[model samples]
Target: MKKLLLFVCTLCWLLPPAQAQTGTYKGIGTIVFEAGAPLSLIKGTSESANGLINLETGKFSFDVPITSFQFLNSLMQERFNDKYMKSSRYHKATFVGRIIDKGPVSAKGEAKVTAAGILTIHGVARKRTIEGTLVQKGNNWQLITAFPVELSDHHIQAPRLSSGYGASTMNVSLRMPLSPTDPDPQQIVAVKKFGFR
Candidate 1:
């Protein structure tokens, strides 16, 4: 009896935690920055953003490659990668946080949501809480949010020569249409159409 009980306890311990609901979506994400002063506003977009979510635990994560952002001007793109963002040094920016849902998040209607987590950019991590909207349409989930980012918050410094060029704060926004973890044929076709591999 004692041996059986020990074996059962060990088996239970090794089992994974209960995930009542889990889903994933592969889609594109974009970022646009509007400078305040003598600088030209820049808008960059990426079709390489990916997102993961756990509805049961209210956990979520997103990742975007630094090199994926494409600027309107080729020279600006080059400078952004080499000088400002330093893509070689810091390859990717990521956010890992949890959703703040007071009640169960509806899989059918739109819900106002907030997420609190650490955002890592240029190798600097800062705690941030962002508000957004979560909407479920058919078999898809869309997360949309827009917020301002301060350059000083992430230790991003502009060159002294161009000190007054770019804005001190940049407005950032994201919209991701996520599909199921195990996508069906229709979902796979949709993912391909979005230009994601």
Candidate 2:
């Protein structure tokens, strides 16, 4: 029995590493916003966005801390967090969705995909479908999407203190970079069998 166990252990060690599996992957990125009237451009960006994606299931989720958003004017930033966004009550904005890729996403190419999911902001959740491009360069994946979000839909009240800040729709852009999470046994098996990164 001991000899048999030794043989099995040796066989396992001799096997190649398993292929990459499709599972939960952690990533960090940014969410940017450009709003105000057509003539007026109000832009702010936040680098505290983090996300996760499952390659096999196409499931994805993203979150951005509201306080991370930065503006050129510190006063505007303060008001945006305390007065307009009310970040004290709602700390983060999040999106949970899946990528609709027509075919398998290549590990080294680019694909145009649409993500449909529920987005929650200011304590309000709404259904949203956003189209974006996914590019895989080396071991990293980048996702970029731009869409218009209506403040009224999320029940975000416009501040009367500044007309420059009020807008019917806010143009939002997302740029996220993701790395693979720890692979499972099955993924390891695949990696060993097929040598997938």
Candidate 3:
């Protein structure tokens, strides 16, 4: 009985840490419009979202409501709101994946990881397989992934363009730097406020 109890206690301690996902992933993620004149746009973000990070296991899940995506430029924001995203129908976008390597990242240090999960748009869920760079500054984990996201994959249609820039895929980029979830012993205060900062 003693041995069995001890084993149970050790296993519990060895298990991965519970999720501490509240980090600073919010940033001005770039939008590359390579279809035409290569227009580049920026979206605004802050340290606000539903994200969970498992420190022990190097796995994480991040989610953002479509309503949170904003652009500082009024005209651009309006255009995005009315056109491309169509946020009303799609309330949120979420990604759940594990880091291929056990990473406690450092500033200027780059590590590659295979983040295979699901991305949801407009209530449609699709598989996501993308590689990303994990940047760590202090305890904050900053993740950036750039990949081709096809609109057609989710029955999504690109907004009608007055100009001829029908690039089949959108070069999507993500800057998710998370700290700790919130109000817990596991809560680690994030350094830079990527989104609001």
Of the candidates shown, which would achieve the greatest TM-score relative to the real structure? 2
Candidate 2, 92-196: lDDT as tens digits: 999999876533356557667778999999999999888887677666678788999898998887543345555667789988887767667554433222112
Per-residue error at 144 for model 3, in Å?
2.1
* lDDT by residue (tens digit), candidate 1, 68-129: 98878798789878988899999998989987643335545676778999899889999999
> Residue 164 in candidate 2 has what lDDT?
50
RMSD of each: 9.8, 4.3, 8.4
The weakest ten consecutive residues by lDDT in model 1 span 188-197
Mind giving the per-residue lDDT tens digits that candidate 3 earns over 14-132?
64432223332333232222232325433445344566655445466777766665556677566555666677777667777765543333346655667777877656789877787
Q: Which ten residues in a row have the lowest lDDT in candidate 2?
A: 188-197
Candidate 1: residue 142 Cα off by (Å): 0.8
> Candidates sorted by TM-score, descending order?
2, 1, 3
Give candidate 3 misplaced runs (Cα > 4 Å): 1-36, 39-50, 71-79, 82-84, 101-108, 181-197
User: Candidate 1's C-alpha lDDT?
Assistant: 0.69
Return whichever of 2 and 3 wins on lDDT.
Answer: 2
TM-score of each model, paired residue for residue: 0.72, 0.79, 0.60
